[model samples]
Target chain A: MMEKVAQMIAVTGAQAVAHAMRQIEPDVVAAYPITPQTPIVEYFAKFVADGVVKTEMIPVESEHSAMSAVVGAAAAGARAMTATSANGLALMHEIVYIAASTRLPVVMPVVNRALSGPINIHCDHSDTMAERDSGWIQFYVEDAQEAYDLTILSVRLAEHEHVRLPVMVNQDGFIISHGVEPVSFLPDDVVKKFVGELKPIYPLLDTEHPVTYGPLDLYDYYFEHKRQQIEAMKNVEKVFPEVAQEFFKISGRKYSFVEPYKLDDAEHVMVALGSTNGTVKYTVDKMREEGCKVGLLKIWMFRPFPKDEIQRYLTGRKSVVVLDRSASFGAEAPLYEAVKSSLYESASRPLLSSFIYGLGGRGIAIEDVEEAFEKSISGELVTDYEYYLGLRE
Target chain B: MAEQKGWKDIPIGGTIVEAGSAREYKTGDWRVLRPVYDRSKCIDCMMCWFYCPDLAIIQEDAVMKGIDYYYCKGCGICASVCPKSAIEMKPETDFAEEG
Candidate 1:
C-alpha cells in the first residue's frame, strides 16, 4: 500500500489534470489549444516554462498533428499525452484510430463539449459520443477530483500489459473543466512509482531489434490486426478493475468499470455518464428520502462496454431510463444503444427507455431527472423511447 | 484463406518479423517489362545501380552485379540512366518464354 499523504488543493478540473500531468512527467505532451481543453495544456505549458515538469511540450498547429506527434512519440517508446475537445477530437479522428490500431498507449484527456454547427460549446457529450467507435478507452469523470485521479490512473491503465490501448480521460467542458473543487493530490514520487518506466512492447526506435507500425495491413492480415485490438479491449474487462483496486490501496478511492449507487432495490434506475452523474446522484438521494426507489449507475469505463456488469445492474429493475447527452440521427443515442445492446442478451431485463438531454450545454436540474424517473416508473411518457428532456418542443 | 497464424502467432501491432522484410515480398510479378543487362558494353558507371527505384540493381564491391529480378518492378529507370545503353527494357514475356 502506498503510504504517501496527499495534499489537499482546490483547483479546476483542467488544473487538476495539468497537475497530474506534472506528476507523471510524461516524455511528450503534444497539444493544440481549444476552448475548455485549452487550460489543461496552458497549465501544463506553465509547468514546462517554469521547469516544474520536464515534459517536452509540442505546441502543434492542429489537433491532428498533436495526436499524430503523440502517436509517433509513443511509437518510439516515450510516454506521450495530449488534450482536446469537440472539433479538435473530430479533427484527430483519423489518427485517433491509428493511435489505437497501432497499440500505442498514449493518454489523452478529452474535455467533453458539443460538436458545433451553431457554435455553442459550454458542456455536452456530443464530441466524445461521435467518436464512440474510435477504439479508445474512455473514463468519464463526474468531478474535478475524478478528472485529477483518472488523468494519473489512465497512464497506468493504458500502459498495462494486458490492455495496450489509448485511454481518454473525459471531463465536462466549462462545467468541470473550469469549476474549482477541493482535490486531494497524490505525491509526485507515488505517481512516478505507480506509473513506472514504460516498457514499450515493440518500440520502433530499438536499433538492435527494429519493428514497424501502421503498415499497409491489407485483407491478408487486416482482419487479424483488428481482432487483436478487439481482444485488447476485451482484456480491459478484466484488467481495469484490478488496476483500480490496486490504485485504491494507495489513494483510498476505489474505481470500477461502472459505479453503482443504491441499485440493490431500485425500481427506477437512471443510467448516464460524465458530470451528469453528479446531478443524478443528488436527485436520487433526494428521491430516496421522500420514499422513491430511484437509483443511478454512472458509467466510467465506456469502451469495452462493461456489458455483463451493466446487465447485472439493470437486469431486473422495474423501470430503466438511459440519459444520452448526444443524439444519434435516425437511430438510438450512443449511450442508449450501448445499454440496450447489453441487455439484449440478458435473460431478465427492465422496461427500458431513453432520454435525449443536455445537448449544446442545456441546463439539467434535479427536477429534470426526477421527472424522467417519475415518467419511467409511471409509464406516462408515450412513444416509449427517445424522450426529449428539457427541449422547447 | 486467412493466413495460417493463430491469434497468438500474429505480432501485437503489425510488427514485421525481420528488418527490411519488404525485400521478402517480391514485386517482380508487378513488372510488365524487364531490364536486361549487357556486361560487355558496361562501363560500370554505377548510375543504373544508383537510379534503380526498387534497389533492384545489386552492387558487390562497388561493381554492379546485375539486377535482382525477384524484387524488380521493372520501372526502366536503370535502362534510362545507363549511358552505355548496356541496360535494355524487354518484354517480361521473354523471361517467361526462357523459363
Candidate 2:
C-alpha cells in the first residue's frame, strides 16, 4: 500500500465534524441550531447550498423535529444525521430513544453542554451522561481530530450488519466544538469508500418487501425487544475494534474503547472522558517529570463502559482518581460510578476517588488536575464521598 | 393460532416483516355489539362502506354486501351511516351460540 498523506486543515471541532459530514454526504441532515453544535449544521448547510454535497438538508423547527426527521429518513433507508446541544438534546430525548429502539443507524454529533437551569452554553458531560441508557452507542472525543474521525467512523459502526444502532459522537461544547485545531482530513474518495452506502435492513421504503417499524410493542414483546437491544449493544463492543482497525488503514489513526497514557507501572492514575483527557494527559506529563508515577486513562466509548479494559488498566495502581464533568445529584458522579463499579470485582482494586469538575463549564486548570493527582498520591483524596475540583468551598 | 415467537425467532427491532399482518389478529373477537345487515331494506348508497373504519363493510362489484365479522369490531358506524336503516346493532350475545 502507498503512503497516505492526509490533507491537514485548522478548524473548530464543529467544522471538522462538518467536513467529515460533507465527505460522507449523507442522504439526509435534519438539524436545529443550538450553541456550539449550530456551526456543524451551518457548515453542512453551506455545503448543501454551495453544491459541495448533494445532501438533502432539512431545516427543522426544533431539535425534537430534527431528530424525528432523521429517524424518519433513516427508516426510509437513507443515510441520515442530526446535531444538537444541551437543551436541544433534552428536547430530542424522546426521538433519540426511538431512533435507537427502532434500530436506525442514524449518526448524531452532540456538542456536550451543561443541562440548563442557569442556562449556560459551556462544556460539560451532563447532556450525554443523562442519556447513558438511551441505547445509542456513545463515543466521546478528545479533540477536533477525534471528533472528525469518529463522526466518519460512527457511520460504519452504526450501520454494521450486526450493530444496527444509532451512534452519538460527543465533543465538549466550546472547548472542542468552538476551539480550533489542526485536523487532518482523508481524501473525499477515501471517506466515501470507507463509509460506503448504507444497506438498510427492512427499510420502510422497500415497497415490494413491505415491513413495519415501531409497532405497538406491549408486555408481550417489549421485554424481548429490549433484550435484543442489549444484544446489539454487545455486538457494538465486538464490532467497534473491527471497524476502528478498518478506519486505521485509511486515516492511520488507531482508536479503542479506552486509551491509556503512561499507565504501565504507574502508581497513581486519573481517568476521564472527552476533552478533559487532554488536560489530564498534560498533567500526567508534568507530574512524571517531577518523578511522580502517575498516568491517565481516557475513556472513548462510554456507552458499553469498557469495564474489563478499565479494570485491567487501573487494577494494581496505588490510587486512581476519576474526573467526572457532571454530577448525578445526590449520587456519585456518572463516570466515577461506572469506574468504581467496573473495579468492584477486581481483587487488586486501586484506592478509587471521584472528583467532580467542570460542571456548568467551570474550567479545570492544569493546577486543579495536578492537585487531584497529588492528593491521590499523598493518600489525602477521600474514597467515601465525592471531591469537587475547582469548586469554591 | 400462529405460534408465538421467542426473541431470537422474531425479527430485531420489533419490525413486522410481513405487510398487513394485522389480518391475523382476528379483532372481531373484541366486539360486544355486532352490526347485522338487513338486505330487504338496503339502499346500497355505500355510506356504510365509506364510514367503516375497519373496512369490515363488505362490498361486491361496488354493491354493498354483508359485513365481514372477522374484522368488524362491532363498531356501530356502519349501522349509523346506513341511510335506509338496513344495518342494526345487535347484542353480540344474541347469537353467542352461533358462529
Using DockQ, give the best candidate's number. 2
What is the fnat score of candidate 1?
A: 0.57
Among residues 3 or more apart in sequence or in different chains, the pairs in candidate 1 whose N, CA or C atoms overlap within 3 Å are none
> What's the residue-level lDDT of A375 in candidate 2?
93
Per-residue alpha-carbon lDDT of model 2 for A202-290, expressed as tens digits? 88899999888888987677988899999999988789999999999998899999999999878998999999999889988988999
- Per-prediction DockQ comes to 0.48, 0.65
Each model's lDDT comes to 0.88, 0.90
Per-residue C-alpha lDDT of model 1 across residues A139-184, encoded as one tens digit per residue:
8999999998898888888999988999999999988999989999
Model 1 C-alpha RMSD to native: 3.7
Return the lDDT, model 1, position A76.
89
User: Ten consecutive residues with minimal summed lDDT in candidate 1 chain A?
Assistant: A376-385
lDDT of 2 by residue, B16-91 (tens): 9996688777779789999988899997799988899998988998888798888899879988877899989999
